[model samples]
Target: MTAPVVSAADLPRALLVGVDFGGKAFFDPSLDELALLAESAGDLPVAKLTAKRRSVDAALFVGSGKADEIKALVQLHAAQCVIFDQPLGPAQQRNLEKHLGVEVLDRTMLILEIFAARARSHEGKLQVELAKLQYLSTRLVRRWSHLERQRGGVGLRGGPGETQIELDRRMIAERIKAVKERLVKVKRQRGTQRKARERSGVLRVSLVGYTNAGKSTLFNALVKAHVYAADQLFATLDTTTRQLYLEEARARVSLSDTVGFIRDLPHALVNAFQATLQEAMEADVLLHVVDAASPTWFEQVREVQRVLADIGAAEVPQILVFNKQDLMDESLQPRTDEDFFELEPGRSVPRLFVSAMTGYGLPRLRQAIADCREAEGDGLINGDAFTTQPYSESDDQPVIP
Candidate 1:
């Protein structure tokens, strides 16, 4: 993982903890995600910890007793920051920091920081800033708590920045409104461009899936574009679209790779990035990328589905593209026959397994996309037709190939 872009003055030692909350029995992919977050924050995670709890403790997220244990570990490890895997309310976060005597941040803030840091384009930066403000607005009330205690140093007067928490929250709300206004204009311009593309009759295909599932790799391989591909989560924040042709159709297809999804993606982030994700919603076809070798592939699929449902993109026609098949054992059954049937029953959405590294199964994957285009052009129904009602709610479901 690349070192976080932190100034020397801001550099701090950190410890990352992934609280299982009785989920340790699962493969615990969030542990890897937290490690990446720690690296992106310019903190070296010298120690890592996990705990199982029935329910979150309101005051100290991991429970008061566990918070004390973490505090001791922080002291022993000389840690300056403690990163948590789940989203922590401002009060819970403040309580944890007070107990540990260190800075504390939840997964949402950590991701926002990374997005703010990685954003290079003007629009991308503005989107991230808007998201930060929206998230900050919700926490302003907690920032000024206990101000009546008269905790202060020299030159700290009762004026200027020492207003009540409610006042600060109102200011943040105003700022959030301003940011939304600016974003509205930005979203409008993006919509205009999308409309132009649609008028041109281009078949838009979006790469949608969990983070680090090799969307960019498959993108670069298929389109021959030099997009950065890394092992880190949320590596690609800005949406990149390229035009590609398959077979002799000479069809114009807008291929987009957007931000990846994760478990419990903050609601603030979902609302903030809705414009960006609208690209997926409006696409003619969606390439749902999956890491074939991951032990938690099924769970990752569910997580992505949850995000899609949250964003109202569940209705979009999706083609399952299981990537990184090269990492799977050769002895495993072929994806074309028994394995594919077992994984994707009834062909609810077209599914193909491919190894972006070895190029194995890619031909079939590409062929599937090509077939989808052909079928679409021929006025044949797709997964969209199954819109009568999804399998989850309906019994007489017809499968589409």
Candidate 2:
């Protein structure tokens, strides 16, 4: 993984730990992405440790020996925290904190922290708060040290700590319900807006891709709107929409830029952001932006597809916009402006090469969008346009080709 863009002086020092269980297929072999995540969450990674285990140790996820090694490294580097690349059980997490003598966090918490920091809009903040509350609800036992102590009072049937935990849990539950209700109302408002757009017969196109894949840059280039575009992960958290008037099709198309996806995205996040992600699900066409210059571009593509499937946007017709072509070497550049990419065994989608930062191949992208608009019009005239599929919840599954 690329080194983090943060200076050690400016960010809290952290030690990264990754465990390799023999049977797990989703583990990152290099643990570089974890470093990126740590940096994205405002942590400066000072050292990295990896362990190979047959299975997780019951008491500590990495066993006592590895824990000691990590502790030594933490002391050596003056690290303030240790981050694990995998999720840990509540007990295991508490145990790690006690053994290491420092704050311990897992990937889920790191992502949640980043979301909490990056959320800008009211709806975005509410969603992040809800996800954080749900995550925190599961680990309340570790938050307080006196959870086992008891108290006796006139109306106190339970221990003081137990009562506190119960009260906090109940408050969180109520807040979650309130947030969900507000989100439902927001979803209804969105649906009404979508119906209005549909009645006007405007084509909806959404930009979807992995985080930091130039989706926001492309959106800015296409519509001339200054939605935040930065080199960091998740530069833009809120979904922004604008109208793009296509000269070729002689029509104004609704273009939306939504949140980017990452590998091993938490289920709580996926559920919390459903109101925002519904833009992609309801889109007439998806512009799946991609970073063509990255070495792991294919893996990134698969990860984005997995999230799309999770959010019920897999079946939408997608046109892959391979962004950042200007950064690619000459030999790796595509010969044509547009071609077909086989995303799965039987699924082939249109692919276009473009550099959103430099306007290279952008005319071709506009032409492609215009072509899709024309095709939709032709289908409507012929009474054979593919009907939009009704959105439904489904179990998250790996998308195997």
Candidate 3:
């Protein structure tokens, strides 16, 4: 299917704002990632404002002076909306919108909107809706500014003598409950399928990494199935599972492509997509893909680790497949394909280099995966739990710039 193209002039002009607290390596100083996120959400970033603040202001977040500067930028660029790189409280969002005279969105809301737009499957749509509702449930005071709080008086469809905000909140609560119930059914269905897979004694492997890290590409290469591989952030939100046969190990494993992670991923989305993420959590092994060409690859690795930890998949045995190797400059490439992941005295997670786009060094990656599966599979039949090593506790190797 051909992708839809959006005109720049038709997209809303977004003014981006970020506050650097200092000492955070994951923080994007240029707000480039935020710009990508805005673009992914169909917004045109017209201007950017970055400030170094010691702490967040209780009301304006960026303090009054910075807020005024942001306001000027918004007006100067004719921005229709303002986006904050950091998450904002409901009151802080309201206060910022009132001060800037434009719609304001936090990082969480931006991600939710992208999910809402890109989600295709029923489970994906429901997960996004649930996250959006959970997020908006707290911001009703800001959402219903025009509607009076205490308007209902016995004849209203909502309830007798009920405030509009209260009625909406109640409705949102009921919806949240209903969506959660539906999700529980989905989870059980997945669980049953997993049990069936277990009965068949198949090895399970999941693809996981930072957004746009070529996970889908690697997945397509491994399984030979087209699962919507794209260059844009969050191109795949739904989990796609296929069977991958490893020739070297002579084993057929269930491979799943999961949603890519991002920096400061919203907790609500994490909670909402728990069922979808179950593939990663319960997989026999995880293929932790990474963009070998990114300058900030080390930081991206840390961000993906954080999400894995949040999803309780930190201990999953991972084979770090550095993808897009063909795009990496030779001068900056790893001195050797060998990398470290010390699991124990004798155990280590193999780090392999591969170009998913061109199929370079895929044989070594496949061999490494087949070996890992052979090792991990031995423990599976005994009803034993196995842990995936992520990193060394005292790993002090200098990050290759």
Ranking by TM-score: 3, 2, 1
Q: After superposition, which runs of candidate 1 have C-alpha atoms over 4 Å from their true positions?
A: 1-11, 22-30, 146-164, 333-347, 377-401
| lDDT, candidate 1, at 372 | 66
lDDT, model 1: 0.75
CA displacement after TM-score superposition, residue 330 of candidate 1 (Å): 3.2
User: Which digits, one per residue and each the tens of the lDDT, describe model 1 over residues 1-401?
Assistant: 99877564566777787776675334363487678777875667778888888888889989988898899899998999998887798899988888899999877888888888888777777778878878887776466666534324333334444455645666677777887888788889889989998899778889999988999999888888988888887788888899888864556578898889877677877888877898988887888898877767778898888888888887677777878877876755342510221223444664566878888777766666676676662221244322222233244322211
Model 2, position 32, has a per-residue lDDT of 83
Q: How good is model 3 by TM-score? A: 0.90
Encode model 2's per-residue lDDT on 232-269: one tens digit a residue.
88888899999999897788999999999988788999
lDDT of each: 0.75, 0.85, 0.84
Better of 1 and 2 by TM-score: 2
Give the distance in Å from residue 288's predicted Cα in candidate 2 to where it truly belongs: 0.7
Tens digit of lDDT per residue, candidate 3, span 1-401? 99888689989999998888886534687998899999999899998888898888999999999999998888899999999999899889999989999899988899999999999999999999999999889889888867866765674456677888888888899999999999999999999999998888888889999999999999898888988987899999999999888999898888899999999888999999999999999998888898988887878888888899898998787777888989988676765564655433555566777899899888887776677677774432222322332345565433442
> Which pairs of residues have clashing backbones in candidate 2?
none
